[model samples]
Target: MRMSLDLQHLGREEEALQVAEAALTDPWVRHGDRLALQRRVLRLGKPPRRWRRPPWAASAQAEPREVVVSATMIKGAAGFKSCFVVPPARNGSGGGGGGGGGATGVPRTACVEELALLHYGSPAGGGWRGVHSEGGVWTTLWALLCWDVLFMDVPEVFRSPFQTAPLDLDTDAFLPARREAVDARLQLIASGGAPDLIRAVWSRRVGTWCRGVNWERLTLDDLLQIAGCVGGLGLSVVCRLLCEDAGGWRGGMPDLLLWRPERGDAMVSEVKGPRDRLSDQQRAWLAALSAAGVRAEVLRVVEAPPPPPLPPPPRPCAECRPAEDGGTQQGTVTTSARSCTAGGKARRRRGAHVCGRRAMAVPIVCEGTEGVTGGCTTDGTGEGAVVAAASVAVEAHSGMEDDRVVINDDDDDGSGGGGEEDQQQLQ
Candidate 1:
């Protein structure tokens, strides 16, 4: 391909086409290389023979499954969406629903996986228990189930006793070198021996360090549940794929493993935030899991709109008391003939007056039952209250200006009470 590029740069179009065609015809050429050569030949004005994709390439190109969910957005430092709508904390506290930190001292803004897990366990989600380990759990499962095959005696692959993995673990030589052993182990797992192998390995090497195993992530019971759900054939396909290319295929597994222990059902989920998209490696794993008969899907999260704000509190009345007929009225006024009493008759004076500081401006005067037609008035003897018969004009104003009620009393005898002393007494 480089030689063809050089030839094309030199304006030798015929030679470039010839070189690319020759490379494409080579039986040993890699599939990627063949595709490159085919494109190169077409660029140089010559069409190669009809092209076909290799079987592995076709399988790798399969589209992954996708799922989308909306999450309630919370305002906080992390701005994280909760994994569960209501995730149980590490402790038994039930305070994981708000924006503040939970009882675990960790903010309630969990990552995408937690939110997705919560969704699945909710009433709408079929109520499955889930664990989020990204690729660690699956790799650990593979390592334990095929422990013997991985640590078997191979020429020059185990030179060092301290080596956690075989020397050729990431090389192309790893699979072919131990093909027979890997095939035997996969057959054993396919025959329903997966749980036994995993249990034996866990019992034998619980705390011992190994390259792919994560001791802290999976418990014995959890591993057994996973094994039962995936079944023999599905687990075999997974192990075979991992054994094929441990280095290239190890890191892109799903983010969550959800299962219903009672029914022996399971699913794997790869979670993505609003703007996240699947990488090439992730797509490949999803495709392989689907082909292996495992329930696998990509979960995309969308932030939902927040709820409406609460209504304001109710306001307090300026002056309120129960009427004689059992209905309440404001501003010391009542339909019954009752005198307006301000702290008894000692404070009561003949005047046009306002009510409280926050009260509306309702100018009411109490002369007598004949003089007070609108508002209440005292009997001046301090015995009882009175509702005057005279019509008193009351102005309805909302706020106070300098805390003063301006009264234009037309009384000539100076008993209308608009002086500063009368204002102070009313206040």
Candidate 2:
């Protein structure tokens, strides 16, 4: 039985299946021989019971709970896979292991946190800085979401804000004002202030939270869902600003500018309302803006909501192997010693597997203050010994070619502070 299991683990599924199936055909077996053998060998049985929906499923008020459940389930699956496949090691014991040493040693969480820092930190120079305003929050949210999706990182901090115990808006006037202040700060940064405000917020909120979270546990779809939430907020603001019915500018607020800095112009004017019901004055303003390089237009926010949830991901395909005769085959199969020899020929005919290809090598040149001091070839196979030897040879040759090379002015200063004595020794 152990031998058969080993064969299955080695991807010889067909051989294991044959061994198990053959055992059931033995004449010594009783009336339930086949079923008993299958139970013992393959562990075949009825599937487990399906999960029951929570009681809140029937109420429209339960939507938030449902969304939480959906997001949790999706992210949980990824987290489970990450933990199971790449469990944290005990100190540095596993550090020196070679290939196929359980799992790759890459630190998934650290990579994600670095990516998030880069995304938020890049916009710190010239543009906006001040207290957060509604508009500024929306802008930052949109940019963060877009960069998050484009770069493919956890974006979990954004989702974390929504999951925190729901805010009591009525009791907490400061909560709304806090969001507004955040927006105003972003506006100041956008207008011209340094990114210090953004850096401060990230250090206080995002950086602190991310330090403890393992980002590798989050999936691509989880990040996308967060982005969708941010995008929805942006869409809400855009709709409100474009559809307002007040004709003349009663407030000191400047006309809404649908600016597209990427395109070097304003794309549209949103007078918040019905497209066909635009007043004559509003229409004239839109026409004038359009002619003057601003593409002005208004769009109404419809009352209809979006569609239902998407289906869960499909299950992985069953493991299988090809027959020795070059014929298609299904199910896990273990090859017999005779069949193994035949399969070798068949594999050769099919061409070398992708994993066999040697990666190309590239030469890297190291430059110092003195000049291009050395060069080394890095073979894509990741053999550090070879790289080190090449690097040493290059350095040795470079040093021999120019024995008097002075790489830095700091090297001239001796710790003893005897500058004249050092100079005399060099001469």
Candidate 3:
């Protein structure tokens, strides 16, 4: 190929054409490569007055690359579960008709016979094989289900054929054929003059899914939009797997077929996350698509809205730190327990000091011990009564312990300062 290019560059058009044509006969040359050689032959053998290069011949750098994210990773932080093929399917949550649950993952592209993908199906023998009769048993929900429409488009090159799309194919790139097949099915559905079959199908299935569709109005615009979407998949696949019917592949595909007016294209999307995952059938379908050269993507718009910002953690009260006299710094008491300064030093009189300025202890709030559990016993008299406080305590190597704090119920008729004193003797 390089030699052919060199020949063409040196103005030896006949020689370049021969060299390029010779390379085309190689059995190892890929289909895309074959097309490249054929184009070169056309260029060198007979250069047109105004030779125009098709997109495939141009450098790859000219096009913008799209980024596809992981759907399994973006499910709700609290609860995330991959999709499984649940029996009695119809596995979407919203749209009109209850498009089953959020488990509806992607389009109907891959053929599901070889493998069981993770986060896409039950790990054991549950997926596609049995019915999930218990609804609450599966706790995982895909967050993608939250959107009304999951929309993304297939690049044009992959939608139709690069050049030679075969009619009959298996495990090969044949979207052109698939498109034909879809159109055929739609034609069958609209055979009785159903007012333009393709348009009618889209009008009924696209927007008001999981609920009900307006069967009255169908249009050609919708059919074209849908045909371009599904990453180049055919409409027969979409109708069979996506549309709502009692016996449809309702439990297997995405919920909606969306159109992006700005790009003038359509996309197949499964709105997820009532809470996330593509079902096994979906995974298989995607696998089959990738094998066939179609681009399948998991488009995550953003990261779950950053989990609502976490509530900022609780702040501690100001008086819980240790104090100079073996008590809380601000002297805060917990529960019905009382606290007052009772340091065994020269008692600072109510308003007396050597400098004629009295020093006072900082006041602390009394917060009761919360988890201490025990029955309380009260004497008939209010003051000067026997009050035995038995608090529930939990030890590192023990059961609930009742620690008693007994008070003679001494009366302080004059001031409240001495009413609840920090009696170190209670410890």
Candidate 4:
């Protein structure tokens, strides 16, 4: 940060601004340092002001976002190896590991998480802070809390608020006895004795949470489903928030809350990206959450990477061996070791492109026999098979190569009986 200022002091205004902007985007920099750098970048500009949203999104400021995963895809092919095989994750591959690493098994999951950190970007018309929005997990956490705290029918007294709410009961009282007893907290809310307390705490955070809980996007059934996975972590997280100084903690929150459906395991997860830093508010929330016995984690999500490519299929080549009867004969009859397919017949591919057509043109190298026949044979008859393999006699031609000569078997209809035939050169 001082360096950028120094650059500016030296009359390198543009260079200073450049340094500030670059520093703002580097994730490895400490969160505090990155924020200072961001401010520096803005201040270095023509007019010093906080960053603003793009012009187009100004109209939609009033809109609340739906708390659902948007349909997305892996658009990058970088480090993309193969298509089918998934590789094991590299150690420390994905992200800063958090929580006790419980039922969430394996590092491949980490690899997946890392991939996202490396690539995800938002368009110019994206969330206020780059592409990612911090307060993302608010709903999932709320939904979980609702499930836990409202397990038994929510007391009618608790549902509606009164003038002198939370008269006697406060977080100080609630935090003492049922502090770690998740069931006790649930029972207290359900029995209606703690109406004022529940109301007070819930109300404290409701205004902030409402920003993300989009009613239009969540169906009644979806809410019901989410409610079940809402566990102890959910309840404790909100209580921790309500107990804190609201002024410091409204917007600095984690982005994701995840749960395993089968076990109902839950986590308070944060996505920390490059050039991104964990804010003090977020750290305070996490500390409070831990003291309350809630499971908290800093996690990441990423695109599944591709596998490595296979070596190019061995190039088609020929191996030759000496033939019988002195003068050589040649044909490397490569056959399938096993049937290529079963039931459905394999379609015969057309000939390789050669000889100015979609077929090979071979010359009959009549070394000693009269003539050779060629064409595919079936049921003792042939078409496109190398017919009647006869060792045709050939006068030692002057312009012949020593190694095997490639010739088309007798696929042509012409008849030349081997005696001094002007051997048309085999292509």
Candidate 5:
């Protein structure tokens, strides 16, 4: 199972799928391992062993809760990788791991979080300092605020001093055993004494090992800042939720913790890229946070449509003062309709010039076959005549190096004048 998860983390989806699928069938795989393997297989786009739910359980269908979903469009810049935004592999390698190691072995610096940090932490985005820990920060705050309640010598819950968390921490028994102490801590947190409790704990046990406290990423000041923004009621609500089912509730906490000290505002945002959807756990967390009066939401990052192509650079009008050479410089004739005066009459046309008495001719070099040489002339001063002459020159020169169209003021139709001088000027 670890091997499969590691492979998935390394972006090797096929091998991860194979390992997870194989692990599901292993007789040695326990119930917990089986569940994990099944989830992995499903994430890899494979159908796992289908075990039917009990009849009673099957009949119970609950309405889905509404979560606040705010959508924002962001340009899909190059380095932004997200399972939702980026196309997944055929085998489905979508996986994510938070700051504190959990079931999903996704890296802490996953592209989704990086993008969130990039956007939300920038000055243009309210300049909120963001922590990318999915639930590690919340867990740490809970642990710090309830340090004494968790470590209270309950029978069977704390069998060894070496254990980071209580024996029944992941089980339902831990809460029941420590309900009294848990309630006391909750009351204290609700009464706005969370910061004091956290400071006391940090002062006493700064370097001590604890279950969910990430000393490396979080500091004393960081915890205080969080406590300040996530006031008594908000922290109390979140702590109670974690206390009820720390194992399950901690898994789907929002991906970002954004707070502005100056404004004293904080919010948790779960970023969803193009095709991402809220998981059942995430929905529950969002609903719970909203109910508790904490700002929690699903930030849907949409891919902004490509910017409209830039208009071609402005070119000199056909009627613009001609160059001193009296010959049109080598440039492609654009298909733009413009109004120009030709001999005291205004004419609007496409790729047609009205250069008055100056009479300028634009030459086109058509490269064709290698050896044969030739030249040609065409009537009319429109660009069509120029194109027609170039085509004729290409057809005549089977393997020629250069073939061109020449125009002079005397010959308004651009006919004849195909010789060494025209060829030299064309060259």
Candidate 6:
């Protein structure tokens, strides 16, 4: 009985009732305790009305819930689940009349066997098998589903082969055919009569293709290759960096153009390369496009292997020296010889220093001889008689005065006065 009460407190109402009933049958419990246990079991059986109605219960009833499934989920449920395939509607007048209303619709079986023949080798089937056979299957199925849903003609359905292949895949043969088919389909869509299903399928294929290519670091050559892959579709490829002169109305270039003649529609594209080492010219072109209100982008490409580092510069000659003017000075004699041998015109100027030595003559003047007083003359014919006789006399007189002043000093003043007078008389 106590155990039953404990179970009821623990919120195990079912277990508590079972334990209570079992305790009532047991002989060990007294009658009064059994009656009390029965009362507790009854209380447990009827929980508070507020507790019975939980807030979660109300929310679960009110809120609408959704289930999200991925591609993997769809693949997992592929066999178990079935889709209703609605056949093309026939004319208004039909032989068959509606009878069973609750009957299940006919199940659709995928025509996988016919897919290889329709898409494998045909020009309409983009050579996607080389890159992604499974992806191709999905893309092709999507295209066909769109055509059937929209009641589009068979020609409009398989137009334009899907050209873009995975980078890791070899698509040499498939790419060209795929491009043609894709273009044809695109043209049909542009005709303004394509159903929404066709548009949706094309959109998915295009998105997949764009995702597959590593657009960054795509080189100009690579862009040209891509253009070639889509060339048959009437696309004109141009580098946005290139200048265009439209009858003197100069303008920056547009990257890519896909024009359709039938619909008079066009698609403009802007191609970009890796950001690393983008040249000034490329940047300017991008800026120009932005200024012109054109859409543009920057993409990255795989870095190519670097070339070998250039060999270290040759060591300078040991004998080489810089000139006093801080210029490189070579051997002067060698330089001069080379200059002369080269037949350079020689320049002449006054007071120019000569390199070789030569003897030079200079004039000298001789004074009068010793003790030769006035009136001593030189014969003009003699080599030694260059000075005039009067000039020689004046020079002799000046010399006598100079000698008297020195020789007749204070030591022999009185005697020198008489001697000086005699000398004067003699002079």
Against the true structure, whose TM-score is highest? Answer: 1
TM-score of each: 0.57, 0.16, 0.23, 0.30, 0.52, 0.14
Candidate scoring better on lDDT of 2 and 3 = 3
Poorest stretch of ten by lDDT in candidate 5: 339-348
Model 2: residues >4 Å from true position, as ranges? Answer: 1-166, 169-172, 175-191, 194-296, 299-427
Worst 10 residues of 6 by lDDT: 332-341
Q: What ranges in model 4 sit over 4 Å off?
A: 1-244, 259-265, 272-281, 302-305, 318-329, 332-427
Q: Write the per-residue lDDT of candidate 3 for residues 1-427, one digit (tens) a residue.
A: 7889898789887788778768877865533345557666656654553255445453311221222222212223444343323222222322221111343554321111111121122323112211111111000010011111211122342344332212221222323324555455445432322224434444454443222232223234433433333223333333333221212222343333333333444332333332245544444333333333333333222222233566765433334334554434332223232322221111111211112222333222222112212211232122221233333221110111322233322444312243454332222
Top candidate when judged by lDDT against the true structure? 1
Q: After superposition, how far is residue 82 of candidate 1 from its true place, in Å?
A: 11
Q: Candidate 5, residue 248: CA error in Å? A: 1.5
Model 2 / residue 20 / CA error / Å? 85
- Model 6 whole-model lDDT (C-alpha atoms): 0.29
The TM-score, computed over Cα atoms with residue i paired to residue i, of candidate 1 is 0.57
User: What TM-score does prediction 6 earn?
Assistant: 0.14
Candidate 3: what lDDT?
0.32
Candidate 4, 220-264: lDDT as tens digits: 343333334444444544534443322234455655443334454
Specify the poorest-scoring 10-residue window by lDDT in model 2. 63-72
lDDT of 1 by residue, 182-258 (tens): 99999999999999999899889898778989887767888888889888888898899788778767777888877
Candidate 3 lDDT for residue 223: 31
Estimate candidate 2's alpha-carbon lDDT, on a 0 to 1 scale: 0.27
Candidate 4: minimum summed lDDT over ten consecutive residues — where?
336-345
The residue ranges of model 3 lying beyond 4 angstroms of the native Cα positions read 1-224, 228-233, 236-248, 269-277, 288-295, 299-427
> Across residues 1-427, which tens digit of lDDT does each residue of candidate 2 receive?
4555677789876676557657666753322223334443433212232144323223211111000000001123533321111113211112110101232444333221112122112232111111112133323332232222212222222334433211221122322334444354435534433233333443454522221132233233332332232233333333222222111211112123222222233233232211124443344344433433333444332222335799985432222223454433322121111111111100101111111222222222122122212321232221221222211111111112221221111342222121221111100
